[model samples]
Target: MEPTGSERGPARYEPGEGCVTTVVRVPVRIVVLVLVVPVRLVWDVLTAAGRVVNRTALRPLGRGLAWLWQTLIVRPLVWLWHTLVVAPLRWLWRTLVVAPAAWLWRWVLVPAGRGFGAAVVWLVRYLVVVPAQWLRTYVLAPLGRGLAWLARGLGAVLGALVRWIVVVPAVALWRWVLAPAGRALAAVVTVLVRETGAALGHCWRAAGIISRALGRCLAAVLRWTLVEPVRWVYRTVLTPVGHVIRDGLWRPVRQALRTARETVRQTRREIRRALFGAPREPEPARAVVPRREPGGSGTRTLGKTSGRDVPPPARG
Candidate 1:
């Protein structure tokens, strides 16, 4: 067996590899190599040429195009926008719109708005605010007070009626009738609950006792009727019959079957050999050679090292 890990080489044989693989690999490799060399050379040459063209011609042309666009197109467009559109728009706004608006606001609208606002203030004070204040003081205040006094009187009467008619009767009924009835009901429920629990517990225990007795009877019946009879039949009758069958009948039958099987197999093997000849023995595997190290033999010892200054010691 060979060592594995890094010592193993990649040239190991696959189990599926056969004469077909051996025959195909050399021709395929040779054809592929022949076809690939020219394609690879052309690809390399094209790649180098593309790099040179991009570096020498395309880069400079792109830079020139960008500069021309900025200088001739972008700068002129910006200049024309400022000169033709922005400057004229600025002047027109100051002359036609801004000046006229400013003058209208300062000269006409401000004074008119001031006078109108003063008139509006005077009219509102006399028409809306004064009337509202007078109404609140004279009419609404007295009416609200009269309605409040009436409501207070009605509330006092209603409160007395509710106390006598509803609250007192309800309180008396709860204290005298409902409270005692509730207490009696609670007591009845408590007695019923305790009795129910006790009855259930007694029933469960009696049932358990009956169940245990019944289980014992059933187990005894089964043991006598089924288990013991089955045991006796197996031991006295079936056991002997099985032994006799095995010794006198089954063993011989099995031996004959085994012999017949072996004979059939032998006959088949002989037929195969007669038709196809005996199978060839596999060739022994060749020994694997260990790989040689690149650095040759490593770490030479002092005993093996030779000295140039000293004469050789003669062997006796």
Candidate 2:
């Protein structure tokens, strides 16, 4: 159909004016189906990936990081901080607290030590050394000197007393006793000499008297005994014989003497005659001279004729 001009002009369905148009209407359910389903599927995939990362890789990484921080990083950092910072704080506290206390004690205690040492030295000097020195000076030295003086004085007094009392008396007594003995000896010797001289004088006189008496008595006894007896015998026996001899022999001798005298005269006459040649003449007889014996006064005649005058010799 080839339709002619103007009518054909616009194969249009006109509702009101001269324009040709087509109007299409969409469904709500179809829109929802396309957009909502794609968005939900993408969100689910993303969520599952996040869970795997956390479980397989991210969780282990987080634990290793925590261990490293505690052991290597965090603990070393804490030790370094204490060494560098906290140690100085503790030293400061000690210096502040203890140093002041020690200084105060030294300042207060030194004076007390010095005071105690000085007190000990003073006590030793006063109690021991001073007292010993005082005793030596005041007590011991004076006592020694006093004792020595007393001993010397006593010795001198004793010596003087012994010499005066004992020695003098002994010497005087000896002299007195010897004087008496000497006087007595002189008296005894004088008495003995007088007695001996008297006795010798008496003995000599007695001897002389006894010798004279003995001589007189001896002579008297000899005359009475031996001499008297011999005289008596001679008187008794020889007196008569002597008288006879004297008478007989003398008568003859007297005759012969007369004859001889006559003859001698005759012979003288003959001799004278012969010589003269003449007869001799006889001469006359001459007178004889008589002898005398000596007497007290003068010579006395001794003859028979004088017998009467002589008083006849005493018979003996």
Candidate 3:
């Protein structure tokens, strides 16, 4: 057993070593001295040999090879491609395709487009739009006016004929013959209408009375049948049961959901702590812990100063 931080000051272990040096540190030092030193020497030797080879032979050889490849192979290929492939193709394309296209665009296509477009516009205005406007103004407009005038004259003649032929005879017949007959018929119709009106008034009164009774009955039926049943169900069944379920079931469900949410939140916090390391707890001010020397001798340090902000010492 060891004396922990609160129980006692720091102490040394057997074999004249502290607890860390005896248990954890000695093997580490031995492994480093025994294994790491030779490996480091071998690595240094190999790297030195490599550096010497590079400086003496390999560097110049690689630089010469690269220069030779670039100057002989790469530069010639690039020059050949530029001279034989690129320049000839560019010249041929300029002479065969681009120059012809430019000439056609400059001389033929552009002039055709402009000239034809303007000619088509003028032809359209002259042959179609202007002719249509001229026909409408000169031929169709006068023809339409003449047709309207002839139509108005014909209508006036027809209206005068109708007035003389139909309306004059009809007025004469009505004034001489139909007026007396219509008066006699209207007198008889007046008497019959009075009698029919009296009868219809009685029928209307009876219908009004019956309709009032039926309307009252319909209102009563609706109230007793639909309204009372709905009211009873709402008041007795729905509201009471709704209250019971809300308080008994829904309230507990909400509380359980709230508790589960809080539990999940706490679990997430714990998981985050485990994954990302512990939360940075507020620290107290630092103090140094030094080893106790034997036989009242001056104190000696086996490791670095112990403080909150002291960086870790170098490794083995």
Candidate 4:
């Protein structure tokens, strides 16, 4: 049979159905249908009656009541508000507040602010800027020049004294006594450094040979005592044991865990289905509506214009 509006969706899936559900479902469905038929019929009758009464009586009555409210109560209230409250408030704001504020800002505050700003500018220029300029130009400039001239003279004198007293004596001492001593010491040091370098090279080569032999002996001992045995044990014993445990014990435990998890999940789903109904299917997507161009009322003529084209009346 073709499905009705109420039965248009896909059928609900039953998971692992058994004997008890099959026996109970048909009889329960029959009893429910029988009990529901009269209630459904009564609901449909009442719904139709309500629609008829609303169309015939209530809609007109509501419209009449709305019109009465708009005419009697709303119109009078709006008029009273405009006359008693809004107009007086507007006049009071314009007269008492706006006029006084405008007069104060224009005649008193603006002029006073301008005068005070001018006075401050004049005071700053005279008391601060002019005096600072004068000091910089006359007093500080002359003082800096005199100090620079004195410093030049002192620097020249000090430079002459330093060159004669310290530089000359030091140069003489280095040239006469220290130069000969340093030359002799350099020659001795050069000979000693050459011999020392040769000896160090021989020692380094001998040490390298000794260290290579020692490293080889240690490596052989470690290979025999630790490395080879550890490698053999890991390869011969640990690898096979690990493989046995993985195959014989771990894999079965993992499989049992996975099966238990799946069983618990299925049980939870069944319990939820028993408590609530099946989850609803998603609604079908609505068809997209194409955009429509604005429609014209009629074809335009040469002399006639649309009402919208007329200019609004000018406000006074």
Give the number of the best model, judged by TM-score.
Answer: 1
lDDT value, candidate 3, whole model: 0.75
How many steric overlaps are in each model, in order?
0, 0, 0, 0
Candidate 1: tens digits of C-alpha lDDT, residues 32-99: 44554455455555777999999999999999999999999999999999999999999999999999
TM-scores for candidates 1 onward, in order: 0.33, 0.27, 0.29, 0.28
Clashing pairs in 1: none
Can you give the lDDT of residue 277 in candidate 3? 87
Candidate 2: 10-residue stretch with minimal lDDT? 17-26
Model 4 lDDT per residue over 138-188, tens place: 999999999999999999999999999999999999999999999987866
What's the lDDT for candidate 1? Answer: 0.78
Q: Name the better of 1 and 3 by lDDT.
A: 1
Model 1 RMSD to the real structure?
39.4
Off by over 4 Å in 4: 1-4, 7-39, 110-316
RMSD of each: 39.4, 99.9, 47.2, 45.0
Could you tell which candidate, 3 or 4, scores higher by TM-score?
3
Of the candidates numbered 2 and 3, which has the greater lDDT value? Answer: 3
Backbone clash total, candidate 4: 0
